[model samples]
Target: MNSDDPLSLTSKTSLGAYYESHHVIGKRLGQSFEEGQRGPLLKRWIGTGRRVLDLGGRDGQLTRHFVDGNHVTIGDIDAGAMRLAREALGVDTVEVNLNEALPFADASFDVIVMGEVLEHLPYPHLTLEQVRRVLAPGGQYLGSLPLAYHWKDRWDVFRGKKLWMARDPTHLQFMRYSDLRKLLSTYFEVVEIVPLKGGKKAVRWPDQFARVVAFHARKAAG
Candidate 1:
C-alpha cells in the first residue's frame, strides 16, 4: 500500500486487533468500573431495556455495563472483536466500517454508544449522519471524546511544542469542544455535556480545561 494513500479498511481491521490483547483500567481489568474516571457518567447515561448499538465496542469491555436487560449489537471493523464480544457477552455482532453508511434499518435503535472512536475516522461527519439515521426518534446518543482544546495543550502550542493526544496513529481528527458540539448538534439535541478529568476548572470552562468530554444527546423526532 502506498504510504500516501488513505488508511485502508484492512489497516482499520488490523487496528481493531489490538483489543484482544489489552483492556482498560476498569471492570474488564478486574477493577471497579464505577471507580474509574467517567465511569459513573457512562453507566448512568447508558441505561437498559432497549436496543443499543455499541460502535467500536471491542471485546465486550465497556458494553458489559448495560448489556443486561437491553438487547445489544456490537459493530466494529474487527472480526476478532466481533467473535470475542459474542463469546464474552452472548450479544449479536456486525462487522462494520464507520467510514461508510450504517447497514441497519431506519430508526433501528433506542440508543447508540460510540466511545472514543470518532477521532480515528477521517469522515466523522459522515459517520455521525448514519448514527442519526439509525437512532429511533428521541433516542439517546451516548459517547465521549478527547477534548482537543485542553488548556495545557494550548499552552504547549504557544510554547512551540507539537503534540498529539495519544501515540496511536489512528486518531485522525482533533477539534475544540465547541467545534465538536456544533457538529453533533447537526443531528442530535444536546441533552447534557460534561467534562472528564477537567476538575472544578472544567466545570466552568470545559472547552479550555477538560481532557475529555462525555455527552448524552437525543435524536429529534420526525
Candidate 2:
C-alpha cells in the first residue's frame, strides 16, 4: 500500500469508515465556523466568477460559499464524501489522490482552495507542485494548515481528549510557520499569510500558538 496514494485505503483501517460516517455532521459544525470566520477572507482573495477547485474538499462543505456566484469543483478520494458533496452542494466533483498527479488538465483552474488538507498528506511538496501545474498563470491557491505544536493541542493531549477535533490519526505531517512559507515558495510566490480568525493585528503578532494559519499564494505568470 503506497502511503502517498490518497485512494490507498486498502489497509482497511477504521479511519476511512469514521470519515464516511462523520463527514457530514462533523463538517456541519466545522463549516459553520469556517464560513463565518474564514470564508470572507477567502472570498476577498478569490473574488467572484472564476474557476475554483477545492482539493480534498470533504462533502463540499467549504465549496458552498463559492457556489452562489462562481464556478466550483471539488476533488476528494472518498467516494461517499464526493457523493454527499454532489447531492448536498450540487457542485461538480472528481475523484483524486493527492499523492498522485491531479486528474485535471494543465492550467485548469483560476483559484484553488486547500483547507485543512495538507497536514493529512504524506507528500505536501509533491502536492504543491501538482497544484502549481493545474493552476493558471497568476492563479491563486488558498490553503490552511494547523500549527505543528499548538498549546491547545498539547493541552488536549495532556487531558487525554483524543476525540473529534482534539486529535486526528490521519494527520501525518506537522509544520511551523516558517516551514509553510518555505514549502509553498518552492512552487508559488506567497502573497499573503494570515490567521484564520483574527484580522490584521494577528498578522502583526503571527501567533505561533495559534491552531491554524491560512495563506494566499500565486503562480508566477510566464
Candidate 3:
C-alpha cells in the first residue's frame, strides 16, 4: 500500500497481534528464543554506553535486553505494538513507517536494531539508507533476517503450499546471505554474519536450515 493509505494503519493492528502472540510464546519457551544465540554478536557490538534506536521493534521483546541505563527508543509503525511494548517493558517508544525516512536527526543514535524487519519492507535499501543517516559514524547496527531455503520454506514446498515468506502480502522481499551482505556493505562495513542456532529439534540438520541470519555492521567513518 502507498504511504497515507488507511489500510496501512489497519494492517498494523493485524501485524501487532501476530507479533504479540509470537513474542509471548517465545518468552514462555525461554531458551528457545533467538536472543540467547544472538548474545555473542550483541556483546561484541554494543558497548556499555550508547543510545539505541530499535526500528520496527514489536513489543520491545529484544530491545529491553539492551536497554540497561542507556537511552533506548523503540520505534514501529504500529501503535498497538508500541502500546504493547510500553505496557509490558515500560520503555520509551515512537511510531514510524520504515518505508519512509525516519524522523530523527542525523547521527542521533549510537546503535540501531532492525530485527526481522528487512523482509517486511518493500524498500529495504531506503530503510538502510535512513539507518545509515541516523546512526553516528562508526555506530553499530544489529539484526536478523530469515534466510531463503530455511526449513519453513522447505516444509511449505513439501506440503504443496507457498511459504509465509513468499505468500505473505506484507513480506515484500526475501534474501539469501549473499544478497543481504551485499546490501549492507553499501551502507555499513560488515563485521559479522552468524547463522542462528535453532532449538534442539531443528539443530539436527544444521546445514539444511537456520533459525535466523544475525549480523553486525558498523556505519563507515566519514
Candidate 4:
C-alpha cells in the first residue's frame, strides 16, 4: 500500500477492528494504567472547570478520565468508533473527519485532547489549526503520539521496503519527536514533552529508541 493513501475504506475498517480489540484488552487491564499516565497533565487541568474536546477519542477510554465533572465532547471520523465510545463510556460524541476542519465555533473549548490521533490524519497540521481556532486563548492541548522508534521500528523497515505506515491504511502520517514538535509549534506554544515508558528499544543505548511522547501545549491568546 502507498504511504500517502491512508484514508482508504479498507484501512478504516481494519483500524476500527484493531481499536475495538485494543480497547477490550485495555478494559480488562483496568483503566487506571492508562489514566495514571495522564496524572501529570490532568493535574494541571483539574478544578479548572473547563470544557474539553477529545479528538479521535476511540472508544472514549481516555475521555472517561476527564469527564467526571467536566463537559467533554468526543470526536472521531469513524461512526463505529464513536458509537462504541458513546455506548461504552456514556459520553457525548460527534462524528468528524480530522483532516477536514472541525465543526465547532472558534474558542469553543478550554482543553483539547488529540491523544494518539494525529498519526492517523492525512493532514495533521490542518487538524491542529482547527484545534487552535476552537481552543480558547491559553487553553491547553494535551496528547500523545507514536515516536519513530516505537514498536521495534516495524514501520521503518516497512518504509525501507516501500511499504507505508498505513498498511492497515488509515494512518496517513508517521512522525518522530522532532517533526511533531516543529509542526505543533506553528499553532501552539509547547509547554512540556513527556516520554512514556515500556517501549521496545532499537539499540543498546537508551537514546536509540524512544517510543511515545506526550505533550502539553497552549493556544496563544489573541
Candidate 5:
C-alpha cells in the first residue's frame, strides 16, 4: 500500500457512503437511540474549549457534537470518511492507520473520542497506548465498545455460529466488559463506564445485557 494513498490499508468502499447507505441503517438508527441516552452524558465531558481528536469519526456525526467550543480533528484510515468530516463539519483531519504509531506530537489533544472504533483495530492495546501518549495530562478519553452479547457473540461461541463481527470485514477485535476495563486501567484512571442506551436501572445491570458500553477516563499521570 502506498503510504501517501488515503485509501491505503483500508477498504476500497467509500467510508462516507457506507455510513449513509442502507447497509448501515441499523447503525444509524442505533445512534438515534444513543443520542437520547449516551449523547448527553458525553456532551458534559467533551463540550467546550478542549482540543479533541475524533478517532475513526466517519462523517462527523459524533465529531460535530464536540465542535461547539472545541478544536475537533478527525483521524481515520479512510480518505473518504475524513473528507466527509472536513466538508460537513468543517473540522481538520489526519489520516491515521491505528496499527501504527499516531502521527502527532505528545500531549497533542485534551480529549480523544473513539466511538465504535476500538473493536476494529488489530492492535487495540498499542492504539490505546498511543492515545494515552497524545492525550494531555488530566485529559479524558471517551469511547464505546461492544459488551459481550448473549444472542450475538456468546451464542456464536456456544453454538458455533460464525463470529458476529466477522460480518464486518473491518472488525478485528472482540471484547467483554472485564477485558475492556482491565485494558483501560492499564493506561488510564477509569472514572465512569456505563451502558450508552438504557434506563436508570441499566446503570447497575450486568454489562453483558447491553450491546455497547461507553467509557470516560482521565489520562494517568504515568
Candidate 6:
C-alpha cells in the first residue's frame, strides 16, 4: 500500500496466484519444505493430536510428520496445491484465504500449525485473531517463520542492500524475535521459542543469531 495513495483502490496479484507460481517452481526443483529440524520439532511438540488444522499447508510437506495420529484438515488459498496435497496425503482440505475471516466455528481445532506462512500475510494480526478464535480453550498454536534480524542481515544494511534474505517478492513482514513475540503475546500465552540453524551463539541469542524461529503458544483456558 505504500506505493499507492492512502485511499485509492489499487490492484495486485492475488495471494493464490503468487503462491501458485512458487508452488510450481518448488515442484519443478524437487523442493520440499525446509527439510531440517523444523519438521522434527513440529512433530514432537504436536504429538498424538487429532482435529488439527494445517494452515497454508501446501502439498503436505510438513504435515506428514504429525498427520498419523491426527485427523488433519488443511486450510489453504491455492486450489491446485490443495489438489496435490489431497493426492499426496489424503487429508481433508479447505479453500480459504488467511487475509479474510476463516470459515470455521469457534473452538473448532485443538491444534493449529502455521509453518512458513506468517511473513506472507498482508494482515497478519487479523489472521492471528482468527486463529485464536477458532482454537478451543487451552488449544495450542505452533508456528515457524524466518527471522530477519540475524548478524548477516545486519551486515546487509552496512553494505547498502535491502534487508531481505531470499528472492521472495511475497514476504511482507520481516520480524525479529521480539517483534513476533510481542505480536503473539496479544492472543496467546507464549510457552516456548526455539531458534533453528545457527551456531552455538543462537542458543543464547536467538533474536540476533538464528535464521529461523519456531514458536509454541497456548490459548488461555476459558
Best candidate per TM-score, number?
6
lDDT (tens digit, per residue) of candidate 2 on 1-222:
444333353445454554554454344423534556566677778889899999978777667767777788989876787787889878899978888999999999999999888888888889988999999999999978776645555677689765234355567787766788888898999998877643554456555455568899999998
The window of 10 residues in a row where model 1 has the poorest summed lDDT is 25-34
Error of 1 at 60 (Å): 1.4
Poorly placed runs, candidate 1 (over 4 Å):
1-35, 158-160
TM-score of 1: 0.83
**Model 4, C-alpha of 113: deviation from truth (Å):** 0.4
Screening candidate 1 with a backbone cut-off below 3 angstroms (N, C-alpha, C), the clashing residue pairs are none
| Every model: Cα RMSD to truth | 4.8, 5.1, 5.8, 5.8, 5.7, 4.8
Best-fitting candidate, measured by lDDT?
Answer: 6
Candidate 4 TM-score to native: 0.73
Per-residue lDDT over 1-222 for candidate 6, one digit per residue giving the tens place of the 0 to 100 score:
432221222243666765666566445222445547778888888888568999988878788888898889999887777888789889999988998999999999999999988998889999999999999999999989888968988998889887764446567898988898999999999999887766788779888888788899999998
| Clashing residue pairs in candidate 4 (N, C-alpha, C atoms within 3 angstroms) | 166-169
lDDT of 3 by residue, 42-66 (tens): 6556765889898877766676677
User: Which model is ahead, 2 or 5, in terms of lDDT?
Assistant: 2
Per-candidate clash tally: 0, 0, 0, 1, 0, 0
Against the correct fold, how does model 5 do in TM-score? 0.79
lDDT of 1: 0.76
Comparing 3 with 6 on TM-score, the higher-scoring candidate is: 6
Q: Which whole-number lDDT from 0 to 100 does residue 54 have in model 3?
A: 85
Model 4 misplacement above 4 A: 1-36, 39-48, 149-168, 198-208
lDDT of 4 at 111: 91
lDDT of 1 by residue, 54-97 (tens): 99787767778788888999998767657778988999999888
Q: Give the clash total for candidate 1.
A: 0
* Per-model TM-score on C-alpha atoms: 0.83, 0.80, 0.76, 0.73, 0.79, 0.89
Q: State the C-alpha lDDT per candidate.
A: 0.76, 0.75, 0.73, 0.69, 0.74, 0.83
Give the CA lDDT, 0 to 100, for residue 131 in model 3.
Answer: 95
Clashes by residue pair, model 6? none
Measured with C-alpha atoms, the lDDT of residue 99 in candidate 4 is 62
